[model samples]
Target chain A: MAVVTSRRGRRTAAPYAFLAPAVLLFSLFILLPVGYTAYLSLRKVQVKGLGLGRGARSEVFAGLENYQRAIADSQLWSGALRVLLYGLLLLPIMLGLALLFALLLDRPRVGLRRFSRISIFMPYAVPAVIASMLWGFLYLPAMSPLNYVLDKLGLPEPNLLSPGSVLFSIVNIAVWGGVGFNMIILYTSLRAISPEIYESARIDGCSELQIALRIKIPLLIPAIVMTTVFSLIVTVQVFSEPLTVRSLTTSVTSTWTPLMKVYRDAFAADDLYSAAATSILLAAITLVLSFGFLRFVQRRAFGEDR
Target chain B: MTSTPARRPRPAFLPTAILLIGAVYCLLPVAWVVAASTKAGSTLFTSFTFAPSGSFFDNMGDLSDYGGGIYWRWMINTALYAGLGAALSAGLSGLSGYTLAKYRFTGRSVIFNVLLAGVLVPGIVLAIPQYLMLAKVGLTNTYWSVLLPSIVSPYGIYLARIYAAAAVPDTVVEAARVDGASEFRIFRTVALPMMVPGMITVFLVQFVAIWNNFLLPFIMLADDKKFPVTLGLYTLLNRGATEPALYSLVITGALLSMIPLVAVFLALQRYWRVDLLSGAVKA
Candidate 1:
């Protein structure tokens, strides 16, 4: 009996053993890099004459200098503000459209539901760089259909890549690429709702819109909150769209977004210390914002259980 | 009781129309790309925007012949990266998620929370640090630079955990154990088959994530030969702004890049059971 019990104990340990690879990989790749970034954020280089040889430029421990520099950098601040503006333009519009499409698909008698869903969701497959490239060309005054129509009607053409219009251009690309996936997520959650709830509401003479507003949307709060948080997180990391757009327009400077600024500092300006500090600062701000947002949503949406 | 039923409220036409309008807005850029790819270089700017010419095939041929088939090479590299990376990611996520879900192990919550924290660490914040670390090991600009990082997906593990908890029953695992089967044997033979659909979902999600990835590949690789399609197209577009002649090739390349992914998405449409909140709730 002791031998059999020992054998059982040995067998049960296998799952944990199998899991070791994933945990090890996560530590080495994810945690170590993050910690290394934090560490690098606190250090800088001390240069000697000409700043040109290996030993001439020695590593020095600079405490908070990089952080102070990052805080004072107007370019970085403007980039963050630009992303905020872009998010302001993007989040409500994208989530609103996603919820609207989801509710529409849930309603009966909608013509061509499958076709529209597939067509709308198709863009999510395209990468942001490619999507921006496609839209960038379409936004060109010479190639755009809108411009063509305006010209035919003898009307003025709008420049999408103009300095004032560039933020909206970037936001529009994000909304186009994002709305469909969020729609599918919300739609899937909508489908998970038991039909009995809606049937009883119908029996009570509630209209479809009433049912949707009071029942469907309320029940979809969890999904909505999840999608919103993810959208916010992704919006904070906006890099590829503006980067691709920058290639086509001079108005999009290298420091158009915080991440873009970090890239430029690290790779273009060769200021790794400043870039590391800026990245760590961005990560801290994102953590505080997201956690704060999550707390607010949980209190308001999920109440005590969450 | 036999009387005609009272009239029901008609569906809200305004909101539905507004939603469809939004859908059109979402689809407009894609439609424009299709139309733009068909125009010749001379006609691209001169012709009416919606008019189709017969230059798509010619542009593709020219793009293929440029720099001895560099565009095709990008496509192949993208496929390899996304395909292999997703496969390995799915395997690791499956194993880890299964263990977390089924076993009553110590430090489970600690381990799981640590992994979940990774989901919140935005990719951009990690990219610069990851690049610097890779530079130390002389691994930058290599395939490993991209592939190594791509294989560890916290979100994938999260999804797989939810799937394992919901899909795999404890009773079956107990039964396999009672029959003298090893834990690994039971997982391989019993749990894995039950988890196939879930694993496929994880694989598709990871594949799309990896394929659509730009910043990582952009930072890690500098060699044009190793560039993925997205980076390669960006460089082409950058050059096109100056040369103007490369415009048609850029358009053609963009169109071609959409085909493989669109095909994969359509084929996997039925399997994408995206229960975003349910996954978190289950955890």
Candidate 2:
């Protein structure tokens, strides 16, 4: 009894010991960086005069100056607005198609379901950089089969990577890469639903369409919302696709998105203060959107928000 | 069997057709890459876009010969980063998650919540700060910069905690303790084997995530030699714009990068059956 109790006492320390590595890493990487960014955001390089010599430009505290510039910056506003519009386009269609394909895949006896499912999910395997590169070449007029077909048919060829249409073009790449994973998540949930529910509903004279609308779609709400929140997060952090395609076309400016502006400020313009401020603000926005959506979802009586 | 004419035989044709359309849309770009990769540099634009050619081997040769096989180095670098990073991330997540799951500790929920909050912070927001922090330590532009930052995945931990709770039973730990085995030994010998499926799932998710990720590596490393395949190919693509010859190499490099990831996807997909990631939340 004495030995057992002593061993039990010793085991109590084990949990904290097990958690040490993760805690250390999280602190070193996530926590410390976030804190450093907050610190950096509060400081600026004070130029003494011409900013030529080592002593000329000194690092000094500049409370909220960086934040003020970030807020007032037109590029940041346009980038945020563009991302908002991009998210609007991406979330609906991507989730909609994902939901539709998932529901269709769930239908019994749907032909080529396996083939369709794998093909759709295949893009999820392709990295965003490579996916955009592949699609980038396809968007080129000389290589685009769309243009080739349009040329043969004498229809107007659309410039997909143009400044005006580039948002949708980027959205297309996102949707292509995103829809499959979301579809699989939904489809998995759909598969978990017992067929007895469908059987009982079918006995009540519900058609297949009605059954999907009333049963599958309604039942998959939690899954849909989960995927949407995820997509929203990813869409906001949209970097790889736009950055890759920027090389293919001049339409995308260096500051095409808020994140891009942050990158440009930090690296190109040598303004780490502004970049840090923008980064924190962006993180705050993301946290708000995430938590806000969760709250909204909870308010709407979501079963799993807590 | 109760059959009804009222229920028009669920037309398999329409569903199949709609699905086929989506599949085509998804595969068209990949198909274009495959065809485009076969063309020699001069004939790349001259020939029809979809027309098949015989220069795939030639382009592969060029890619291998370029920069003293730096393309191959990127491939090795990618495997190192993703493989080592994911393995460590999964291990740490597993240990932490299992601790959070099976143990009653002070600030357990607080720690879990704090870690979960990390998932919501977008990669862009974190990338610059991480870059700056690493630069301070003079670790920037080094492999450790990318690998170290990626080793901590909040999502992996969340999934691990869920898996440990769902799969690794408390009774097993107790049983192991009664046998006079150490706590660490029990975790290694008893709880971990049961959590194998979950660990693999976590590892695969992190692997793909790190592999597919561009911004972190792009910001961290300026040296092309240290670049992952994605960044290397991006720079190659950038150069392709001014120099058309590099385009063929870019096309071939893009195709080569897809193979390993797609192979891993095909091989490990069966393990995703449990989906402990999202399964945690569903009631």
Model 2 deviation from the true structure expressed as Cα RMSD, one decimal place: 3.4
* Backbone clash total, candidate 2: 0
Whole-model lDDT, model 2: 0.86
lDDT of 2 at A165: 85
Model 1 misplaced stretches (Cα beyond 4 Å)? A1-7, A49-54, A292-306, B1-16, B276-283
Question: What is chain B's TM-score across the candidates, in the order shown?
Answer: 0.91, 0.93
Share of native C-alpha contacts between chains A and B (below 8 angstroms) recovered by candidate 1: 0.58
lDDT per residue for candidate 2 within A1-306, as digits (tens), equals: 122223467776787789888989898888878888889999998888788977998899999999999999999999999999999999999999998898888876577778899999899888899999998888888778888889889999999888888888899999999999898889888888889999988889997789999888888887777788888888888888899999999999999998888899999998889999998999888888788655543344323324
lDDT of 2 at B129: 81
- Expressed as tens digits, the lDDT of each residue in B1-283 for candidate 2 is 1342455656468777888899999998888889988999898887788887999999999999999999999999999999999999989988988888888766666787788778887776677888877888899999999999899999899788778877877787888888899889988899888888888888988998999999899889989999999999999999888998899999999999999989987888776543464463332
Residue A156, candidate 2: alpha-carbon lDDT: 95
DockQ comparisons of all candidates to the true complex: 0.49, 0.54
